[model samples]
Target chain A: MDNEMNYRKSLNKSTNKKVIRIGSQNYVVNAERFKEFKKNVIAITVSVALAIATFGYVKDNIKFHHEKVDISLEVYDQMVDKGYKPVPADGEWDYRYELLDGIDPFDLSIYMGSEDALSILQYRGYESWDDYAQQEGYKNQRDWYNAQKKKVINPETKSKGGK
Target chain B: MKPLAVGEMLTLGDEVEYVVMSRLNHNNKDYILFANIDNPEDIVVRIEKFENNELCLMGLENSDEFDSVLKLFGDQINNSL
Candidate 1:
């Protein structure tokens, strides 16, 4: 019995596999189970990461929140009713923009429609921007617009350096 | 003062959003106005009520009415100033 025990102990040491002895029984730890568990953990982690990334991409591209969707829907319907056909989503269409946090004023030109702009001002019965500015109690259109913006663009610098 | 007292944000034909200035009640008829916030420009539209009582904005082609509205605004300005 001692000889057999010594032989098994030597075999276990040579194989580099863990072996557990309980009373008169020997139980070998299964390396395959541990390898399977590690593989599953890695696979689950990768899948979760992929799912999160895909969700973000879809949300940014085609998904709008319910409120935006509803407002846009009504706007689109009214536009269609006014004989304005919905063109394919094009670059000319400035439908989406980031919300202003009130720190940086939005550039009105970005949202200005030249046609609407001219007509609206025309309604004021002014032949030109300068005329409108003076009649409407402003120094100029630029001044009035700046007043509306409540913030000035790049201020002019006094000439501190001159040859 | 804004050219249009009451305003709503609207997207025009080019898919740009703007605020329609005001709906003025003149002689029991409504006139809708659009103004560029950044510029002192405006579009004046007379209100047209459809068979279903749905109101739509139409260009103010009537020169007489246009003059009247302009005068009204001038009066308001004078009063405010």
Candidate 2:
């Protein structure tokens, strides 16, 4: 009976030693450090995704605007072809300068052409001469052209017309 | 096509402000002429000298009216004095 008890005690001591060795070798990783690493990775991924989305949106908007301007130009040309007459100012004028406010100059010039005076008159649908001149840019261009008209003379005699 | 007379007034379409002048020929028999718009500067052009036709243009200062004017009036210039 004494021998059996001593054997059982020895067995228990060996099992406890194994359990301690296993627990020491396999350590649990630091939960706080792991969480911080995951957060940084997520932040970087979100930033990159946002940047790509922004770039795409900007590019698409520019393309859409350009196409819209192009379509507008085509419509204007069609209107002109349909017997739309330009309403002239009071007197004969020379070069008319129409100022386009709050618009892209290059794009406006391309689609509308350089004759801003005529374009405005056509756009406004003014039938009579007086109604057309009342527009802001129309009056300005007409006035400027009128001032310059006196200088134009016959190339041969360099004299003003008798009429 | 006949050459543009001295007193003839050719109205360039809505975009431009110029009249066709008399037609002359270049070295290649291409019809060309002097034009005067509202500006004092005399512009040389090649145009068809029609009696009462209007030519539409885009820009007054920098226009391809000269070329179009030439093509349209080249034949008329050949017939002019």
Q: Which has the greatest lDDT?
A: 1
Best by TM-score: 1
- Tens digits of per-residue lDDT, candidate 1, B1-81, equal 122235344433323333443355788765554432222222323443443343333445444455455445434433433
Give per-residue CA lDDT, model 2, range A31-138, as digits (tens).
653354345533433332332233233333444556557645754554445444323256432223233323332233334543554554545465433344344233
Per-residue error at A116 for model 2, in Å? 19
Per candidate, native contacts kept equal 0.00, 0.00
TM-score against native, each model: 0.27, 0.21
DockQ of all predictions against the true structure, Cα-based:
0.01, 0.00
The runs of at least 3 residues in candidate 1 whose Cα sits more than 4 Å from the true structure, single-residue gaps closed, are A1-163, B1-5, B48-53, B77-81
Q: Can you tell me the CAPRI class of model 2?
A: incorrect
Q: Write the per-residue lDDT of candidate 1 for residues A45-153, one digit (tens) a residue.
A: 3333333233233332232333335434554564455554434255343332222112111122223333333433454455766566566566766765545333222
The digit string of per-residue lDDT tens for model 2 on B1-81 reads 343344344433223223333444444333334333333122433323233342211121222333333334434433442
Error at A39, model 2, angstroms: 4.5
Query: How well does candidate 2 score on lDDT at residue A70?
Result: 64
